[model samples]
Target chain A: MSDVATRLDVLKTYKLYVGGKFPRSESGRVYEVTDAKGEWLANAPLGTRKDTRDAVLAARAAVKGWAGTTAYNRGQVLYRVAEMLQGRREQFAAEVAVSEGIGPKKAAALVDAAIDRWVWYAGWTDKVAQIAGGANPVAGPYFNLSTPEPTGVVGIVAPQAGYGHSLLGLVSVIAPAIATGNTVVVAAAADAPLPALSLGEVLATSDVPGGVVNIISGRTADIAPTLASHQDVNALDLTGAIASDGPGAAPALEAAAADTLKRVVRPELDPFAQDWTNAPGTDRLLSFLETKTVWHPMGI
Target chain B: MSTVAANAPGVAGSGLQDVAASEASLRRFLHGLPGVDQVGLEARAATLGTRSIKTTAKAYAIDLAISMIDLTTLEGADTVGKVRALCAKGRTPDPTDPTTPRVAAICVYPDMVATAKDALRGTDIQVASVATAFPAGRAALPVKLADTADAVAAGADEIDMVIDRGAFLSGRYLDVFNEIVAVKEACKRPDGTSAHLKVIFETGELQTYDNVRRVSWLAMLAGADFIKTSTGKVAVNATPPVTLLMLEAVRDFRAQTGVQVGVKPAGGIKTTKDAMKYLVMVNETLGDDWLTPHWFRFGASSLLNDLLMQRQKLTTGRYSGPDYVTVD
Candidate 1:
């Protein structure tokens, strides 16, 4: 009845991304996400272990087609992601500022860095194979050359700390895994999942195929173990597990990964304290690749 | 229900009573059958597929699934050596583990039946051969019958024949029915012993769930020992919903007539998990009667390796890799 007319803000219901579609967790459970000041942001899907398995299935199904595509086409698809991300820069910066308790200027800078990271990896899609593979000198009369192939589906534990770290860390993990044709099932940052979930939107709008990049927003502990022990997952990144609770956290995941002999990438330093702005090296790009050495007999 | 019995051959002493006296009667009978609610059927299948079979149940299901495989190799490039290797795999899926049960049968093309028969000698494993021009049943009637006769003469225990889908889609139901009866008759050897006749509908070409249901009944009525879902050559092969619908047809057909018909969902079923889902569906839908190898079979080649790997996992108490199992 007051003279002042105030409108209600329409908040988003954050959901998980699987096979290029946004769907609620199959368990139908959600958790409240709050900003730096403990103010209600949104209710994010509390993805269960089953959700992790489903995401892996989708990623595995996508591996053949995504890897079979020409490297030039892959580069074009990745660049499309950067274009989409640039278009949504304002929304991402605002969300990063609220999630990390940072000022607007700092959040904008972080968003710009994350956008530029996608373009950087986009250019590397067609070049990684050439750099990682080459001819080998053999003892016999034969032509031996090693070519890098994708190691199938990869499971990633995205960085789960603050604002800039969440977005930048996600870009760091996903770009390398996919730039070389491997698909990914990522467990997004539990605390600041908004940026990662928004990135799923960008990926879907880009030429990135369905099931190439699946994002699940939930507790890292609840989801990481299933991905670690899954028989079909070819590799796992334990970047977020280093910052997780309990003394046996990272080691237990590594042990589970050993059941499948998955190629495990352990963070070299404390994940939360690392400087994400520094230029990433080829170590991450080489993590999810397998080298196949071809031999041909030298004909007379 | 009584109407199906009146037309079905070898049922109620009808001796191939014509189900479709006229085109109108054929349409009436097909339309009279229950309409399939596609959404509900798919939902039911997906719900059953989510049942988490673990530990003892998973172990048991894996073995049962292995035993039910009609280990198949139907490629144009198949040779005697390939059939021999396939028969060896069927007899002993996992050579390292003697506990592995031999498969139900070894399915091959008609010309390879002699090799499979020779390789499976002195074993209870049956040899199944695809006849009726196999993947495409486009030949003349005489040639199709001769194809079935050759496989049966070569000691095939079962003959899988494809229906002329071109005829079935063009409203010639009677022609389709007569072709199945002809194939069934051709399965008889000179000594009066006959190979079991399995009719393949190739559901992917049938185009609709309602068509699947109609063809299931038609194949059963024409005296099919087993109603198969596909020839494994189409884009959309045996899916869970289609298999579930076929299971319903067999269940209902058996209810009306005293005779029992089997179901085989062939093609695209590769993993142990997928085999388990089909087993779960059979268990819940048709009950325990259809759980045996005689009543249900998976026409697959790669599915056997996955089942063996899972079986090794159960016995070894640890996950087994592909290197541990033989690849034939």
Candidate 2:
């Protein structure tokens, strides 16, 4: 080996992504993040409740601009995210391998699947309106039509215990809510947050507007509850919430979400039994949407 | 008039411009004032800004700051409807809660003074008009005087005039002093009761702490009823140090001349916490005499909403959002 004093590698400092800018936790707190084997990897920002409040603010500010965009343009922007992820597939695969304790080949497969998940959701952006909304049958002589609108800002806790699908599970939850024109503030998997944090870089470089999707990592218990009860947040995604603060966390979050009448996506029946490699559906997209029905006078 | 400015011939009084008998004497008097310790002044302002104001104090400060706000809309695009809406918002900041204190005044361009006054009728909330070639004092003496007269005739309770920074910077202290004297005289209405005169320094253009100090005293000596920091139109509006310095100047001015002047730090002060810092600075520097709405004000539009949001957060258990407040 040629000796040049063994060129040192520059380790990445993981930070919270909010409002399109990377900021360390406002609390200046970091927690020791270990690999699957419990080997030290990095210190992820220990995002606090204030971080949740800030992310919610950013997500709320982005709602009008993101939702007002044409659905076709939104699809293109989401598809561009998939393209950016494709180019960085190897970097994410390496991260996934260490994070999930999997072989490179398996990690690569998961990364590919996550990229495809984005593509799948990207295709649904434009079609959700036609499929989820339609003309309704009524007794009155009126042309009544229904259209789906985003439920404003949605807060997500990515699955932390589902076969350690750290990258896949995180991507699966995030892509759908945003594809439907809803801005999101997501809590990455607490145990394995490197891949999720790196996704923020990809999103920033992609065409996604700042504040549209804020990625915050720490204990889900520290962040999710605030999002649940926040008056500004319109919906909650608890798909990965069971392990956030132990047993009954999801139900507690749902109870808090009810204070503001927020629409909640409850965790799976058995969170540990869930898998992200399964075929995706439009349920995640529809769960965070409100149906806007309009009645027009009809005369021929 | 039962006001401190009555001693200085600013509102409903005779000429007090006699203090500066000549240009040389005015310059000697201004330069004769103590030099500012730039580092010390800034350090003290910074230290005071860091003081933790919490809980009940925060709630009180929020309401006090609300009462001291001159809710302003000085854009050229301002319409009658917009001014009326602003006045209504000023009258009742939070329609959801009737207990919220109304703002001090509704500040608009001179042309919109009539509209704001009309809308704010039946309420004690004064209508303050920005005159004397506001934001930029680049007009002739007659034009500036006529602008002040027009706003005064249209029922403006206070006139916010700007100092000719060009003349002040060129060592023509007498020109700037004379201009302020003329504007103060123009503030008089036919009923012998005159509107209060608040002089704006545009301190960001003044270049140093010493200039801010110099102008603060200059404005006070020129019969200014109030001394303001900026027009909220500059790139650098109000900072803690400049405001602190102005507060100190007004303090010393009252000590010497027995004529107290108000202070308004407009622009860039957006949060309840920032407003509290200014309040704390005032409390420490000027004491209790200058804490009332008649003595201090915040010339801001967005700061009102933030203060309301904080006030609501205090009243309600949960945090508030902009959607819960008015658009302004």
User: Which candidate tops TM-score?
Assistant: 2
Candidate 1 lDDT by residue in tens digits, B1-328? 2344354555655432445555566667776788899999999999999999999999889989998999999998999998998998898889888989999999999999999999999999999999999899999999999999999999999999999999999978878877887888889888887899999999999989999999998888878999999999999899999999999999888877767899999999999999999999999999999999999999998999889877876786444445566676
Q: Write the per-residue lDDT of candidate 1 for residues A30-86, one digit (tens) a residue.
A: 998889899988888999887887788789889999999998899999999999999
Interface RMSD (one decimal) of model 1:
4.2
For candidate 1 chain A, the 10 contiguous residues with the lowest summed lDDT are A241-250
Q: CA lDDT of each candidate?
A: 0.88, 0.89
Give candidate 1's error at residue A121 in angstroms: 3.3
Model 1: how far residue B260 lies from native, Å: 2.2
DockQ agreement of candidate 1 with the native complex:
0.12
Alpha-carbon TM-score of each model against the true structure: 0.82, 0.89
Candidate 2, after superposition: displacement of residue A246 in Å? 8.9
Model 2 C-alpha lDDT per residue in residues A1-300, reported as the tens digit of each score: 777688788988999999999999999999989987899998899998889888988998999999999999999999999999999999999999999898999999999999998888899999999999999988888999999999999989888877546889988888999999999999888889999999999999999999999999998887887787777888889987875454229988888889788889988888888877988677888898899999988885
